[model samples]
Target: MRLFTIGFTQSSAAHFFGRLKEAGVTRLIDVRLNRRSQLAGFAKEGDLAWFARELCGIETEHALALAPTPALLGAYRAGEVDWPEYAARFKRLIARRRIETQLDRARLDGACLLCSEALPHHCHRRVVAEYLRETWGKVEVVDL
Candidate 1:
């Protein structure tokens, strides 16, 4: 099984949706620390759901399985997190009930982990992708 993780920075919603359709994504796993966005249509969850249904016939879920927290910040700062090491400590912290409580057991056909940062190298989603890859096997990190 291949797990895909990606971020949508300044890319247009229509463009991202099109790419997702081409990618065969059946569901979107949003890993944003905060669900709210300042950008136009992306800010409203209803708008995204509508777009997903009409454009790609896919589904969207704001999964807390990859949330960031203060403890996570501290770990990353202390070097125990190894932000660049790939297998992020943040994933384990997030898996805890206090921060996150889910296994992402949902369907994985063309699944993408969504975040705000378009650049994968600079985004926490990159680390998240790595964690999932190491734990679960094959995984893809798409940055656009």
Candidate 2:
């Protein structure tokens, strides 16, 4: 299965949706702890879902099970936890949650994990993808 990951920061709406379209993303799994944010603009939950469906014909679903806890995210944002620690904790969180079983395997075939980090290098979305690849095997993870 092919699993893609993306971040919306520093990207225009046109570029974001365009990439999704080009990637043939059929579903967008939003792995964000908070779905609503004033700064998200076009990437806000409702707006993003609408645009994804109308423009790219992509289904959108928010999977909080893949997101970090509010405390963990807050600590990371507050500089209490570094990226390494944050990534480790996030990985453990997902492993404990057993997302490999919780998420439908078929839905992820052409799905892309969505976050707001602008890049997947330090994002939890990447961790989630990698975890799935490690556990399930044969998952081609592409960062878009």
Who wins the lDDT comparison?
Answer: 2
> Candidate 1 regions off by >4 Å?
70-92, 95-101, 104-106, 140-144
Candidates' lDDT values, in order? 0.65, 0.94
Q: What tens-digit string does per-residue lDDT give for candidate 1 at 31-85?
A: 7666655563563566777787788897888866576775665666577756554
Model 2 scores a TM of 0.98
lDDT by residue (tens digit), candidate 2, 1-144: 999999999999999999999999989999998879999999998999999999999989999999999999999999999999999999999999999999888989989999999989889999999999999999999999
Question: Model 1's lDDT to the true fold?
Answer: 0.65
Tell how far residue 86 is off in model 1, in angstroms: 11
- Say which candidate scores most in TM-score: 2
